[model samples]
Target chain A: MESIRKLSFQTSQFLSFVSKNQILLMSLLFVSMIFFSLLAITFGSYGLSIVDFLLGKTSDIQNTVLTEIRLPRVILSGLAGASLGISGAALQGLFRNPLADPGLIGVSAGAALGATLMIVLGGDIFSQYSLGVFFIPLAAIAGSSLVILMLYFMTKGFGYEGVTYMLLVGIAINAIAGVGIGILTYISSDSELRSLTFWTMGSFGGVTWPLLIPVILIIALAIIIMIPYSRQLDLLQLGEPEAFRLGVDVQKLKYTIILTCAASVGASVALSGMIGFVGLIVPHLTRLLGGVNHNYVLPGSALMGAALMIIADLIARIIIQPAELPIGLITSAIGSPFFLWLIFKIKKL
Target chain B: MTISAKSISLELGGKKILDNISMDVRPGEILSIIGPNGAGKTSLLNVLSGNIKSHNGNVSYNNTPLESISIQERAYIRSVMSQFQSIAFDYSVEDILQMGWLDHSHKDIKEDLSAFQNRVIKECDMENLIHQKFNTLSGGEQRRVHFARTLLQLWQPANTKDQNYLLLDEPFSNLDLVHKVKMMESIKAKASSGTGILMILHDLNLAYSFSNKILLLKNGRVIEQGETKKMLSARLLARAYETFISIDENPINIRYY
Candidate 1:
C-alpha cells in the first residue's frame, strides 16, 4: 500500500515535470550548462578559480595555464558537444530514424581520413608555413566537403529519394574512409603513430586559441541554421510528402540538414577526434527528459550535450591524477550503459 | 474557384498510373475518388495534391498554378493526410497532434491548440490518448489520433473567402465502424464549414454516403464522374470495378457480391 502510494506520488511529480512550459525546461538546461562550464574551469592539475582570476591573485604561469589550456579546452568541448548534439537531433529528425547520429552522414570518418593524411604526409612541409595549426583542420574540412559534394551529386540536390541514397552512400564512404585510415596508420612513423592513436582515441589537449575561432564560427552558423527549422524537422516525422504538403520545402530542408550537420560535425571531429556516443546519447536524453518536439529537443540536446561533455571531460581529467583518460573513452563508457538502461526503460513504458 | 487538374498523366516505373485525368474540387464540397484495386485512384489523388510534380499536365489551385505557390504558403491553405504516417521516435500524442498548428496564424484562434482540443479529442475518441506515447497506441487508436490531428489542421471559421482544403488517402482503413461514422461526421462538419475535401476511398458505400461528388476510375481512366447519386450508378460501378454489382432500391443499398 505504501509502495503504491509512493509510486503514485512519483507519477504525479513526473506529470508535473512534463507539463511545465518548454521554454522553462530549456532554461533549466541552459542554467545547468553554465553551471557545469564554470565548475569545469576550476578543475585540472594547475588549480584556478573564477574568484582568483577576477581578483588577479594567480601567478603568471598559473594564469597562462588557465588562459592557454584550460579555458580553450572547456569552451571547445562545450562547442563541439553542442554541435554534435544539435546536429544529431536534426539528423535524426531529417532521416526520420531514431538511430541517426552525426557520424551517420560520413562526415566524421571523412574528416578523420583528411586529418590523418595531413598528419602522415604533410609533416614538416606545413611547419614552414605560418598556418601550421590550420593545415590539418583545413584538410579535414576539404575531405568532409568532398564527401558532401559526392552526396549532393549522387542524390541530385537531395530530392525525394535523397534520404535513402544518403544513408547508402554514407555507408560506402565510411568503408572507404576506414580503409584509407588503415593504410595511413601502417605507413606512419612511431611518433606519428602515437599522435594518430591519441587523436583517434580523442582529446581536447591540442585545443588552442587560434584553432577555436573557426570552429566557433562554423558551429555557431550550424546552430543558427538548425533551430528555426525545428518545426520543419518535426513535420518530417510525419513523412516526406506529408511534410511537403504541410509546406516544408522538403528538398531545401534536406539540403540544409545535410550541409549544416556536415559543417559542424566535420569541425567537431577536426577539433576533437572521434568523440563517440555524445551525438547519439545527448539528443536521446533531451527527448526523454523533455518531449520529442524538435523545438525543445534541438536546443535542449545542445545544452545537455555541452553540460555532459564538460562534466565528462572533468572526470577524464581527474580520474587518474596527472595522466588524463581520453574524453571519447569516458563518453562511450558511460554513454553506452546509460543507452541500454534507456532502452529497457522504453520497453517498460 | 476550384482546385483543378487539367489532363494530368503520370507514369511510374514504366506503368501508367494516371492517364489524362481531369477533375476539380471546390470549396465546401466533398469529392470522393472511388475505384477497385489498381484503379489509380490514389495516383490521381497524388497528382491533384501537388505531391507528384513530374506529372504531364497542370494543376491549378483557386485559379493560380499550383507550382507558383510556395510550400509554406500552400501549407497554410491545405492539409493532407496520407495513407501512412509512422513516427520514428517516442513523441507524446499531444506533440504529434500539435504539429498541425505549424501553419495556423488565424487571428481568431487567439490561444494555442487548446481551443480545439476538447472538440477534436471528443470527436476522435482520443481523451485517453492525451499524455500517451504515440508509438505505443494500437493501430486503430493511432488512426483515430491521426484523424484527430487531420481535423485540427483545418478550422471552421464563420465566413471566409480564403478556404482551406483537406486531402486524405484511405483515411478510414484502420478505423472501427463507430469511429468511422464519427470521423465521417467530423469531416462532413468541416466541409459544411466551407473547407474543401478530396479523398480516395476504397469503400463504395462510405463514398456514396459521404461524398457530394464522386469519380469512378478504372485502369488509370475515369469510368464515370459527377453527382454522387448519379455517378454511383450500378451499371457504371460494375464496369469500373469489373464485378457483378447490384443496387437495391427502397433503402438505397449498393453491393458487389
Candidate 2:
C-alpha cells in the first residue's frame, strides 16, 4: 500500500508539472516533427536508409535519391503543413469559429485557380515580359490577395453580422472559383490539363530544390509574422468590440491576419496544391491537447501539422509503390472523419 | 483628470445615432447613464470608450486627444465591458478571466491571477465555475464571469496612484437580484478606491442609489446631466422615460406605473 501510494503521488505530480509547462510540451512536439520529417525522407521507392547514410555506406545513386529528390519533397511538405496549420488556427481565432479553414474560406481555391491560369495562359505573357519562372507563385499570391480583399469588403458591409455573412460569401466565392478552374481545364492543352489535375489533387512528387527555395522563404516569412498576433487573436475571441475596448486595434489586426493568411495559403497551394484538413484538424487537435490559448494553439498546430503532413506524404508515396497517390486524398480521408467526430463531441458537451 | 466628451455626434447610414452629446466621467465616482430603448445609451458609451469614432467633436482622456494615444497605452488606463459578451470558443472560465491580463507583462497564467483577481472572482461567486467551459454556463453565470473579467483588467495590486476607468454597458441585465446587489457593492468599493466607473443601467432605483452623477438621454440627446439627487426627480425621469415614475425618498425606492 505504501509503494502504491508513492507511485500514485508521483504520477499526479508529473501530470500537474506537464500541464503547467506548455512550452516544454510544445518543444517536445517540435522535436517529434523533426524526427518524423527525417524519417519521411528515407521512405521512397529507392531502398535508402538513414542508417546507411550516416555510416557513409550509401551508394552514389542512393545518396542522390535521398538528398536531391526526397529531401526537398519532405521539407516542402513540412513547410506546407506548418503554414496551413498556423493559418487555419489564426483564421479560426479571427472569426471566432472553429470551422474556419484556409481551404473552406476559398483562399486555397483562389490560389489553385491562379496557378492553373498561369499554367494554361501565362506562357505568352511570360515570354513577352521575360519573366522566367516566378510567374506561378506571383499569380497565386495575387489571386489570394484578391479573394481575401473581397472577403474583407463583404464582411465589412455586413457590419455586426459579419461572421455568418463571411462564411456565406466564402462559399459563394469558392463555388465561382471552382467554375473558373473548370473553364480553364476545358481550354487547356493535354499536357497542361494533366499538370492541372495533378495540382488540384496536390502532390509533392514534382518538388525540386530550386522550386522549393522561394516557396519556403515566403511561407517562413508569413508564419514568422503571424506568431506575434496570437495574443491579439486571443483577445479577439471575445468579439471585435470587446477586443477593441480592451485596447486592440481591431481593424489593423484583422487586415494583418487576412494578408498573412493569404500569403501563406497562396504560397503553400502554389507549391503543394490544395492539401486540405491540416489547417482544420491540426489546430483543433492542438486545442484539445494543449488548451485554447493561441500562444499554445498556434505553435502547437504548426508542429503537429508538420508531423501529420510529413506522415501523410510518406503514406502517399509508399501506398502505391512507384505510383504515388495525391497527398490531398490521404489528408481528406483522415480529416473529414475527425471533423465529424469533433462536431459530435462539441454537441455532447 | 477625467474622460471628457465635447459635442460628440455620430451618423450611421445617414441616420443620426448620437447628436452632439457631451459628458464628463470623473475620478473616484460612479456615473450612470439611464434611458429607454433606442435612446443611444450604448452608442454614447462606444464613443467614450473609443470603440466608435464620433463624426464631430472630440473625446479626450486626461487632457490628451483619445485618438492620439495608442491602443496599447490606452489599455493601461481603461477597460470596457459591453452588453454583448458572446465568446465562441469553449475556453475555460479561467482562460476567459486570464485574458484580462493580456496587457500585463506577466507570462505565467497561474501567477497572474493575483490576490485582487481572486477576491473579485470570489466576490462574483465564480469559484465553482472557473474550471468549467465558459459556453456551458447559463446566461447569468456568463455575465458574472465577464464581470469578473472586466474587473480583473483594471485590478492593480497594492498600487492606488493610477486613475483607471471602467465603462460597463448593462452589466446588471442578466444578473439575479442578489448578484446585482453584490455587483453594485463591488463597483462602489472600486470607485471608493479611486477607479472611475461609467455604466449604462435600466434599473432606475439601482442607478439612483449608487451613482454620484446621472445623465439622462433621449433621442440621442442629453435630457439632463447633474448630480443624481438633482437629476433624478420624479418629473424629469417621467418626462425622459414617458412613464409615470414615483420616487420614494427615505429608503430610495422607485415605482413605475
Candidate 3:
C-alpha cells in the first residue's frame, strides 16, 4: 500500500511537471496521439493483427484498408479538428468575443453552399476527370474567401467598431449562405441530396490518400501562418484601439486572421463537411487546462483538438461496426451537453 | 523632448470634432487636458496615440513623425491607457499584464522578464490580485490591472529614459480613495522619472493639484493653454465648463458646484 501511494504521488508529480511546461505538454500530446492512432488502427471491423502490421507481414487487403482507407480517414479527421480548433481560438481573439467560432462566422456554411452548388450543378462535369477531387474543395475555398473578403471590405474602420462590424457582417453572410444552402438543397437530385446529407452530417468514412493530401497541406499551411500572429492575438484581447496603440498593426493583423482562419476552415469543411463544436470548444478547453496565453493555447488547442477528433472518430466507427454514424452526429451529441456544462462552470467561476 | 501636435483638425460626418487644436507635452512633466462632456479630449488622445488615422495634422513624437513609426516601434516611445476596456475572454491578471510587454519592453533585451513583471505588479499595487482571474476582479481592481498593464509597456525598473510617455484617460474612474491615491502617486512618480504624461481628468481638484501644464478645451477647441497655475482659474474654468466654479489657493484645491 505504501509503494502504491508513492507510485500515485509520483504520477501526479510527473503530470504537474509536464503540465507546467507547455512545450513538454504539447510534445507529450503529439507523441500520445501517434501512439494512440497506431493503437486505434488495430481496432475496427476488419480482423487485423497489430503484431503483423508492425512487422510488415500483414496481408494485401489489410495493407489496403490500413493505408488507403483507415489512415487517410484518421488523418483527415485530425486535420479538420486542428483547423477548426485554431481558427476558433484565432477568431475569438480577433473579434474579442468568447463565442466566436468558424461555424458562427459562416466559413463552414459558405463552404457548404459552394460545394453543394458545385455538386448539384457541376457534379457530372467534374467526376469524369481524374482531377475531380480538387473541384469541390476549390469551390468551397472560393465561397469562404468571398465571405472573408466581404467582411474585410465592410469592416473598414479602426478600433472596437471594426471588430463589431466583422461579427455583424459575419452573421449577415452566414444567414445568406444558409438561405443559399437551403435553396440548393431543395433543387438537388436524389444522388446530389445524398452527398448534401453527407455534408450536413459530417463523415470521415470515404476519404482517400489523394483527397486527403491537399487538405492536410492547406491546414498545415494555415496553422503555420497563424503561429506567427499568436502574440498579436494576445494583444488584441485588450481591444483593437489599445492593441494598435501598443504597436500592433491592427489592419494587417485583422487581414491575416481573416484570411488564414477562413482558408483553413474552408479547407476542413471541404473535406470533412461540417464538424461543429471542436473549434468552439477546443480553445476554451485549452484555456481552462492551461492559461489564455495564445503561444501555448494555439498549439495546445490543435493537439487536443486532434486527439479529441481521433477519439470521436474511433467511437463513431467502432460503435456500430461495418455501418457507421456520421461524425457530426456523434460530436454534436457529445459537444452540446459538454458545452452547456462548460457554460455553467464558467458562469460560476 | 516633447510629443507635439500642431494645428490638428479632425472631422467626422461633416462635423469638426477638433478644429485646429494643438498641444505639446514635455518629458518629466504632467500635462492635463481638462474639459466637459463632448469636448474632444478622447479624440485628441486617439490622434496622439496613432489610434486614429484620419485626423488632419502633424503629430511628432521625440522629433519624428508619429505616422512614420511602425505600430510595434511606437510602443517603445509611449503607453496609452484608454477608458472603457471590456476583455472578451477570461485570463489571469498576470497574463493581461504580460500583454503590455512589447518586443523589448525592457531597457536591456537580455533583462529577466519576470523581474520587470514583478516590479510593475508591485508598483501598480496589484500583488494580491495578480494571480486572480482578471474578469472576476471588481471594476476598480480591473482598472488597477489595466493601469499596471499600460505601465508595463513603458515599464522602467527604476527611472524612465528621456522621450517615452504615458497617456491615460480617466484612469482613476472606478478606483476607491485608497487605490486612487496609490495610482495617483505612481503616475506622479512616473512623470518625475522622465516620462511625459498626458491624461484626460474628470477630477478638477486632482488635476489642479498635480498638473504642471494644463490645456482647457471647450467643444474641441483649446480655450486656454499655459502653466497650470495661470491657465487654471475659477473664471477660465467657469467659462469653459459653462458652469459656476470656485477655487482655494491654500494647498491647491478646486471646487465645482
Candidate 4:
C-alpha cells in the first residue's frame, strides 16, 4: 500500500512538473530526438548497430559506413528538419496565420529552381571556372534571397492587408518557378535530368560531412538569432499595429524573420534537395502538443522537427532495404493525413 | 502636460478622412469624441494617437514634437485600445493581459503591478475567464479583456508621478449595461489617478455622464468643442448628426428617434 501511494505521488508530481515547465518538456523532446537519431543511425543496408560500434566490436567496413555515410545522413536529416520546422514556426508567427509555412511563401520552390538550374546549366559553363561543388548551394541561396526580396517589395504597400496578397503572390511565383524547372528539365542531358528529378523528389543520399558542415553552421546561426525574438513574435500575434504600439519595431522584426527564414530554408534545401511537409506539419504539431507561445513553440518545433525527420528517414531507408525511397514521400504520406485531422479538430474547436 | 494636434489633415485615396482637426487632451481629464458613422472620429483619434501620419500638421506632446519621441518611449506615455481586437493565436486571457506589461521597466512599477494586474482583472470581471482562450470568449468578454489589457499598460505604482494617457476607440461597443458601467468606473478611476483619456464613444448619454469635455465631429471637421455640459446642447448634436434630438434637462440625456 505504501509503495503504491508513493508511486502515484511521483506520477502526479511528474505530470504537474510537465504542466508547469515548458522548458522541461522541450528537454524531454530533445532527448527523444537524440534517441530517434541513434535509432536511425543504427539502420541501413549494412546492418550496423550503434551498440556494437560503441562496444568497439565493429569492423573497419562498419566504421566507414557508420562514420562516413550513415552518420552524415542522419545528422543532415536532423539539421534539415530542424531548419524547416523553426522556419515554419517563425513564418507562421510573423504572418499571424497558423497555415503559413516556408513553402507558402515560395522559398522552397525558389531553392529547387536554383538547384535545377545549377544541375542543368552550371556543369558546362561553371566547370571551366572550377566552381564544381560550391556552385549549386550558392545558386540556391541566391534564388531564395531573390524570392524573399520580391516578396518584400510586392507586399510593401499593403500594410497589414498585405498578408493575403503575399500568399497569392507566393502561389503565382511558385507556378512560375515550376514552369522554369520544367523548361530546364526539357533541355537537360540524360544524367542531368536524372539528378534534377531526384533533386525535386528530395533525398539525403548525397550528403557528405564536408558538404554538410557549412550548411549546418548557416542553419544553426539563423536559428540561434531567431531565439531572442520569441517575445517579439508573441507580441506580433496580436496583429501588426498592436505589436508596433507595444514598442516592437515591426519592420525590423519582419526583415529579420524573412532573412533568417530564407537563409535557413535555403541552406537546408541546398543540402537535402526538397524535403516537404516537415516545415508545414512540425510547427502545427508542436503548437498542438504545446501552447502557441513562440518561446516554447520555436524550440519545441526544432526538436520535434528533428525527431520526425529522423524517423521518416529511418522508414525511408528500411522500407525498401538496398533500394531507398525518398524521405519526402514518407513525410508527405504521414503529414498530409495528420494535417487533415488537425483541420477537422480545429473546426470542432 | 498635454498632447496637442494642430491643423491635422489626412487624405486617403484623394478623400479627406480628417480635415484640419485640432484637439488637446490634458492629464486627469476625460475627453470624449462623438459623431455619426463615417464622421472621421476614429481617423481623428488615429492621427492624435500617432498611429496615422497627417499630411499637413504637427502634433506635440509636452511641448516636444510627437514624431521625435521614439516608439518605445511613446508606448510608456500612451496606450491605445482600438475598436478591433484581433488575436490570431490561442493565447489565454492572462497571457493577453501580460502582454501589456511588456513595456514596463523591470523596477518597482513591474514588481508592484502583479497585484495591480490582479485588481484590473477583477475590476474587468474577467476572473472566470482568466484561463480561457481569448478567441473563444464572447465579444463582450473580449472587449473587457482588452480593456483590462489597456488598464495594465497605463498602470503605475502609487508613488510614481509621471503622467500617462489612454486612447480608446469605441471601447464600450458590444458591452452589456453592467460591463459598460464597470468599464466607465474603471476609466474614471484611471483619470482620477491622473491618466488622461481620449475616447471615441457613440453613446451620447455615457459621454455626457462620464466625460469632462466633448468634441463633436462631422464630415471630417469638428462641429463643436468645449466642456461637455456647454457643448452637448440638443441644437449642436442635432446639427452635427443631421437629425432631431430631444434633451431631458433634469437627468441631462439626449434622445434620437
Candidate 5:
C-alpha cells in the first residue's frame, strides 16, 4: 500500500513536471531572448531608451545606431542562430545520432562553395549591376540543394546498408569544397579577398534592411515547416527498422528532413557565413533541460540559440570595445572544447 | 481475423535464409513456432512483420494483401518484440513506456500504459524494477519491460475494428522458470482477450503446454503444424530437433532435460 501510494505520487509529480517545465521554461527563454535582443540593439555606439524607441523621438545618433547599425545586426544574428540550432536538432534526430549536424555534414561547405563561385564568376557578369549580392545567396541555396540531392540519391541507390559511409562521404565532400574555396581565393583581388575572408570567418558586420527580410522569412518558414515533424522525430530515435515497424515511412521521412535541414542551413550560412557549434551545442543543452522529446527540443533549441548568440555578440562587442571581434571566434572558442568534452563523455559511456 | 503466408522466401548476402515457408495465425489463439538455432526463426518473424520483403509469395491479413495496407494500418494490426534490444541509453522505465505510446493518443496513453504496466509488473513480479534505468535492469527484468513496451504497442482504442496481433521472437529465452511461466500465461491471457499471438520457442514442452497450435520448422520449411497435443509426439519432436527424448507421461506433465 505504501509503495502504491508512493508510485502514484511520483507519477503525478512527473506529469506536473512536464506541464510546468514546458510552460514556464518556454516563456522564460522566449522573454529572455527578446530582452537580450533589445539590449543588443541598445548598446552599440550610442545608448537609446525604450521610451525614446516607442515614442519615435529619434535623434540622429540614436537613429543611426538603432536603425543602420545594431538593430539589423541583432536581428540577423538571432535568425541565423535559431535556424542553425533548429536545423541541427532536426538533422541529429533524423540521423538518430547525436553527433550529426548540418554544418558537419557539408551543407555549410556546399553553400560556401556556391557563394564563393558566384562572387568570383558573377562578379564579371554583374560588374555594371548594383544588386551583385543577390546572385550569391541564390547560388548558395542552389548549390547546397544540389549537394543534398546528390547525397540523397547516392544513399537511396546504395540501399541504406551503410550509414557510417554517409558520414565519411560528407567529410570528403566538405574537404573537396574547401579546395574549391581555396582556388577561388587565389584568383580574387585583395579587397574582394578581404571581404570573402571576413565572411568566411563569419560576422554580423553588414546588416541592411533588405538583407534582413529574406533571412527572417526563410528562418521563420523553416521553423514553421519543422513544428509538425516533432512526433515523427521522436519515433525515429528507436532506430530505422523499429521506426519503420512503428509506421514511419523511413526513407521518405529521411529525405524530407535532410532536405529541410540542408535548405535552412544553406540559407543561414549564406546570410552569416559558417557560424559554428550553435547547432551542436544548443540542441544538446535543450535535451539536458527539456528531455529528449523533440516537441519541446525544437522550440527550446531555437530560443536558447537566439539567446546564446545574442549574449555571445554582446561579449564580442564589449571585450574589444569600438572595434568588434568576430562573433564566430567567440562561439568556436567556447563551443569546440565543450563539443570535444561531449564526444569524450559519450564515448566513455 | 486470420493471417496466412504461402511459399515465402528470403535471400540475403547471396545466401538463402528462408525458403518456401508457409504458416497461419488465427484470431484469439496462441501459435508457437519451435526451432533450433540458425533455423531462421527470427528472420521468419521479420518476414511476417513486413520488416523485409519476400522474394516470392505473399502474406495476407483477413484475405487482404498485407503489403497493400498502409504502414499505419499494419502497425494498428500488429506489434513485434525481438529477443535483443540494444538502445544503450540511461532512460527511466517510464520514458521507455512513453516511447511505446507513440501510436497512442495522449489522453488515453497515460491511463492505459500505466494500467498495463502495472498489470505486467504484477504478473512478472517486476514491481521493484519499475523506476530503475533500462540499462541497469537484469536480463530477465529488461525482457519483461520490453514485453510491457510491446504490449503498449498492442493497445488501441476500444472502438477500433482491426484485429490486434503480436509477434514475439524467443521472449522466454533469458527468463527464470517462474517468470517464464508468468509470461506464457500473460500471452495466453492476451489470446483470451481477443489478440492473436505468434511466438517462437526453443522448448517444445513449453510450446505444447501453453500454445493452442505448434509449428515445427526445420531448414525454413514447416515439418509439422497442428493442434499442440496431437502434433507434439516424441517421434515428431525427435525429427524436428534431432534429439532423443524419453517420454515419461504421468499425472503431472513432465519432460526430461
Candidate 6:
C-alpha cells in the first residue's frame, strides 16, 4: 500500500518535472527558431544586416535578394518541416505502427507524380500565367487525396478483414509511383530535368510568403482537428477491441486521421517537393521525450520539427559559402544516423 | 442493473463461432460461462461486451437496446479485460490504472481516483509492481495488474440509469493457483459491491464456487444454465466437453479418471 502511494507520488513528480521542463524547452527552441530564421533570411550570397533590413534602408541588390529569395525560402522550410513532422507523428498514432509515415504509404509519391505530370504537360500552357505555381500544389493535393481515398476503400473493401491488406496495398502503390517518377524523369529536357531533379531532391530556393499560406493553413487545420481526438487515439493504442469498448468509433476516427495526414503531407510535399526523415524521425523523438501520449506527441513534434528544419537550413548555409547545398540533404544526413542510434536505444528500453 | 443477451449468434469468415447463446446477469451477481476450447466462451463474452457484433438477436442492459447506445455510452457501463494485451511501448502500472479511471463516465471521480487506486492496488497485491513497466511484468503479474485495472472499472459508479457490465475472457488462464483464488475473491467482492460480471472459467471448482450463476456451453450453445450448485454435475461436464470424466463428491474433487 505504501509502495503504491510512493509510486503514484513518483509518477506525479515525473509528470510535473516534464511539464515544467517542457515549457522551458519550448521557449528556448522557439527563441532559437526565430534567431535561425532571421539569420537564414539575412545571410546568403549577399549579406544584409538585420538592422538595415529593419530600418528599411537595404541596398537594392540586398533588398531584392532578401524580399524575393531568402525570406520565402526560410519561412517555407520552417512550415514544411512542421507539417511533415506533425503529420508523421499523427499517422504513426493513427495506425499504431511506428514505421507508418506519409512517405511509406505513397502519399508523397502520389503528390510527386502529380507535380511531375503538371511540370511535363503544363509547360507551354502553364508558363503563360502566374497560376502555374498554384497548379502544381493543386494537382499534388488532388492526387494525394485520390490515392488515400483509394487506399481507404481498399482497406475497408473487405469489411474489417481489409485492414491487413491496406499496408500491403500501400507498398504496391508506392512502388508503382516510384516507377512513374522514373519514367517522367526519363523523358524530360535538360533544364526542366535538372530542375525536377533538384525539386525532387528538395529545395527551399524559391520558397516565398505566397507559398507559406496554404502549407501553414492546412497543417494548422489538421493539427487542430487531431488534438480533440487525442484521448480517442490513446484508447486506440490499447488495440481495436479495447478501443471499441471504450466508445471510439474506430472506422470514423481512422478515416478522419488518414485524410488529415494525406492533406497535410500533400500540401507540404507540393510546396517543398520532398523532404525525408522529418515525418519518421520527429515522432520517435517526441515518444522518447514525452512517452506515447498523443496529446504531448502531436504538439511537441510540431515545435521540434520547426526547430529541426531551421537548424538544418542554418547548417546548409555555413557548409559551402557562395554555393548552397539542399537543406533536405542535411536533414537526411543528420536524421539517418540519429534514427539508427534511436532504434538501438529504444531496443534497450 | 441487469445485462442480458438473447439468442446471440456470431459467424465469421463463413464459420459459425457462436450459435444461439443467451445469458443474463443482474446487479450484485456473478455469471461464469464454462466450456471447453472452441466452445465459444470467449465469443459469448465478446458479444455481451459489445466488442464483437452478434449476427442475430440483441443485447440489452437495463432493458435498453445495446445497439442504440453509442460506444462511448456503452463504455461508461462496460469494460472488458481480455485474455491478453501486448504493446511495443512501455507504461507504468500506475499509468495503466490511470487509463482505467480515465475511461469512467463520471467527471467527479477524477480527484477520488488516487484514493480508489490505493484501495485497488492493495486489493490486488500490486504495491511493489506499481512502478514496473506493464510489458516487463510476468504473465501472471500482468494479469493481476490488469485485474486491478478491471476492478477500478467495475467499481465506478455509473450514471443512475446506466448498468455496469464487466466482461472477463479467460482472465485466469495465466495465473497460478494462489493468484487465481485471490482474483476470484476480488471479483466476488466487486460483484457484491454492485458490478455485474460475466466471466469465462475453465476450472469448474472456481466457477461453481464463486459464481452465483453458471452457464454450460457446448458447440456454441448454452446447453444448460442455472444456480451454480444445482446444475453443476459430472454428466453436464462430460457431455459439454465430449470426454469421459468423473466427479467424486465425497471430498469434492473432480478428476478425469
**Tens digit of per-residue lDDT, candidate 1, span B65-171:** 88887666676567778776567788889877876654333454435346776778887778889889998888888877777777776654334346678888888
Report clash pairs, candidate 5.
Answer: none
Deviation in angstroms for B12 in model 3?
A: 1.8
- Over the stretch B1-257, how does candidate 4's per-residue lDDT look in tens digits? 88889999999999998888888999999999999999998888778777788999989877678888776666667888996646667888887887786433334544466788888888888889999999999998988888898888776546545667899999999998788878888899999988889999998988898899999999999888999879858898899888999878557444332
Off by over 4 Å in 1: A1-21, A104-106, A119-135, A145-176, A185-194, A337-349, B104-113, B156-160, B250-257
For model 3 the local lDDT of residue B2 reads 86
Supply the TM-score of chain A against the true chain A for every candidate structure: 0.82, 0.87, 0.84, 0.85, 0.85, 0.81
User: Candidate 5, which segments miss by more than 4 Å at Cα?
Assistant: A1-19, A124-135, A142-171, A190-196, B83-85, B88-90, B102-127, B243-257
DockQ of every candidate: 0.39, 0.29, 0.33, 0.25, 0.32, 0.33
Model 3 segments beyond 4 Å from truth? A1-19, A123-133, A148-194, A339-349, B105-111, B156-162, B250-257
Residue A72, candidate 5: Cα error in Å is 2.3
How far off is residue A302 in model 5, in Å?
1.5
Clashes per model (N, Cα, C within 3 A): 0, 0, 1, 0, 0, 2
Tens digit of per-residue lDDT, candidate 2, span A197-229: 565568877677766777888888898888877
Instruction: Please give, for residues B1-98, the per-residue lDDT of candidate 6 as tens digits.
Output: 47978888899898888888777888888888898888888888888877788999899887778887667667667788986556545666776666
Spell out the clash pairs found in candidate 6: A247-B71, A247-B72
Worst 10 residues of 1 chain A by lDDT: A1-10
**Cα lDDT computed for each candidate against the true fold:** 0.77, 0.80, 0.78, 0.79, 0.74, 0.72
Query: Best TM-score goes to which candidate?
Result: 2
Candidate 1 falls in which docking quality class?
A: acceptable
| Interface RMSD of candidate number 5 | 10.8
Error of 3 at B34 (Å): 0.7
After superposing candidate 2, which stretches have Cα over 4 Å from the reference? A1-21, A124-133, A157-160, A183-186, A190-194, A340-349, B102-113, B157-160, B250-257
Model 1 scores a C-alpha lDDT of 0.77
TM-score of 5: 0.88
User: Compared with the true structure, what per-residue lDDT tens digits does model 3 show for residues A200-255?
Assistant: 76887788777788788778998998877777788788877877777777788887
What are the RMSDs of all candidates, in order? 8.0, 7.7, 8.2, 7.9, 6.1, 5.9
Q: Comparing candidate 3 with candidate 6, which one achieves the higher TM-score?
A: 3
